[model samples]
Target: MRIESVHATPGVSGFYFDDQRAIKRGASQDGFAYEGDPVTEGFDAIRQAGEALLVEVELADGTVVRGDCAAVQYSGAGGRDPLFKAEEYAPVVEGPVADAVTGREAEEFLANAELLEELTVDGDRLHTAIRYGVSQALLAAAARARRTTMTDVVADELGTEPAAEPVPVFGQTGDDRYVNAEKMFVKGVPVLPHGLINAEEKIGSDGEALLEYVEWLVYRSRELGPEGYEPRLHVDVYGMIGELFGAPYDRDEVVDYFAALEDAAGDLPLQIEGPMDVGDREDQIDAMCDLRAGLADAGVDVDVVADEWCNTFEDVRAFVDAGAADVVQVKTPDLGSVHRSAQAVRYCEGTDTRAYLGGTCNETELSARACAHVALATDAAQVLAKPGMGFDEGFMIVENEMRRTVARRERDRSRAAEEVTAGD
Candidate 1:
């Protein structure tokens, strides 16, 4: 269907609630930390606040599809900066850019990456934010038109199905101490301790605590027995490993860390995400491959997952081609459009490479729905639907849409089967 009109609703009300803590870091007001650090760093703070983009797309059929683009604040500090910043740019986008997209065929608008590029202001995060919001709205509209769930749309777009088993997911927890891998068996997912692996907070940098943590994780998994567990420990290096352990550390130190991690993990698998802030593309790939190789040498079969480094289609292609990573962490905003993101996933199809739907800490229902569509479309092995978990809104919208999509798909499949039976 053709996009009749694309506009932003007026009254950019704040979604902020008092209970939410800002992701920004500062000392007490009037203190040295506050003096040196501004309360907001524009887009940088926005990335942390987990902002939502509210968008409306009107189709020729008079269907007005409205949705939000949930932007994740990777920095993990919670605040309203991202939302506030997105609001600031709403006017410009709703005014001109929306006008530009109106009356265009939805498929055409989505296909024209070049035309969409003209609507953006280079390097402006708001531009990125607005573009993301619009893309999400259009995607929702398309899904509505097809009378299908976003996931089904995505599945049709990309040929795949849910893994025979749910793929395990891991994230960094608060303590540098990695959670015992056995916890994943109980939770039905992988647990990568987050707080423990912060680049700046190297409390356990010597590898002693990390090793112990891994051992506990592995031992617990073994205790649970094979049927109870999926053998894999997930880690988020978050670019710090590259910065902190760069050439200065002897290869032995690196080898030691992987060796210990492997020994602790036992027969289970290990997947490392990050080392994000590598110096260059080639360097990033090299580091990932090197780490993967190191772990393998230690008898730890591991898969390296990429985040920041795998930001675009080109990035995905590069990582896959170089054999630098085994899995691609797909984030909606990182690829800008659901279609483009789906294409990126398609690119990885049939290869040894796999894709996982990564979570944006701050996601709204609309954005989450769009992401689900992408996940379904791309047949991502796993997805994170933690809507409003990190932010105030929680998962209401995302959960609702996810349910709707699944139900719709089931009905469609059942109807097709019935049609075949009736014909016979």
Candidate 2:
């Protein structure tokens, strides 16, 4: 099937409740808040409306593939977006890639992995994002065309189905100390600390607040111990703790941080998100590697998860090749297409490293459904479904849809088996 059309739809919405004081309380204590303006940049306020991307691609057989692309702000110091802008690649979607895909075999479009990067000009993040949206739609269309579930397509491609066990879900709730962890515990999703330790004017440096925050987390974990739920807690440094400042912390300091987290979580498994910053690439990698080593030396059974530094398959390979991370956080859009993302997952198969299916806070139903397929397509250890805590209702809707899809697939399989047995 050749590519028939590539287009985007943009919408404005907010994820946070409209209570300003409550928002401030949460943001100040947790170091970040979901409330903010929709404009892509500038302004520090609770509840900013934001835009989402919807893409549609059609094939020669009149099959239509459609999905959403969510442009969300990364919730940390960098203030950099996750790079899902639609306008950045409007030309390619409306131009050459569109031309190359039109009337081509659907399989060929799916199989031609290099077309994404090749069609992209300047290798901008937007190109990758648009490609991701289109690819997801195509995968869904391909699944429908083959009368198969997206998971089956993935299983066929990967050569093995992912373990049937439900992957654990984790949420970054700013600071775990402020929220009722019991609510999340009841929902069966563990808590991950949003990487903001210092946002208050008098908080001095973030390091100081981070240390205190970790201590508080430990106390809360102990308090919840009697509830028969020893929930695991992880830290998302989000490119904060590293050896780049004038007075960089040594490996021991890094160990100390993990130790504090361990104590706080009652020795539960820890996952460190990232140490990636804009210009500190070398130092960040060194610090992360050293931090991993320190965790090993201290007998801390923790996993290092890469986010920013591992945006694509190449980055994922580089992280594993360098031994800088134990788990690679795979964001669907970051990898451009489910096909390419599946390849990255395959690359990690049979290795000690694990993959986590991460979420963008601004996702809609289309993107989330596609993401579920991608998750099922890979052997990821965990999946995060936080679409800004119910603001992006589509996120939750897609998750439910995925669950239903899985159930339907199983039912169909069972029916087929019964029919075969009756025939025999």
> Whose TM-score is greatest here?
2
| Candidate 1 per-residue lDDT over residues 1-424, each given as its tens digit | 8777766643322222111122212123232112233343343322233445577777888888876654444421221123335556667667777767777666543453335645545544344445566777766765676776656555654555633222333432433243423333444444443332543444255555555666676666656635665545666655545544555223445666566666677776766666444545677777777766766677656566777556666778888887777887776565666666777777777887877666564455566667766665565655553453222132334435555666666778799999999999
lDDT of each: 0.56, 0.58
- Model 2 Cα lDDT, one tens digit per residue, 1-424: 4556666555432242222233324343224445434332333444445455566777667777776655444422222334333455455566666665555555543564446545645555335556666677666666766677777766775676754544555555633335634445444454454433323332225455555666665566556545655555666665455432224456676576666656555556566676434344455556668778878989877677777656667777876777777887776656666677777766777777787777565556677666676666564676666566542243345456567666877888899999999999
Error of 1 at 245 (Å): 3.5
Against the hidden reference, what TM-scores do the models get? Answer: 0.76, 0.78
Report, for all candidates in order, the number of backbone clashes.
Answer: 27, 15
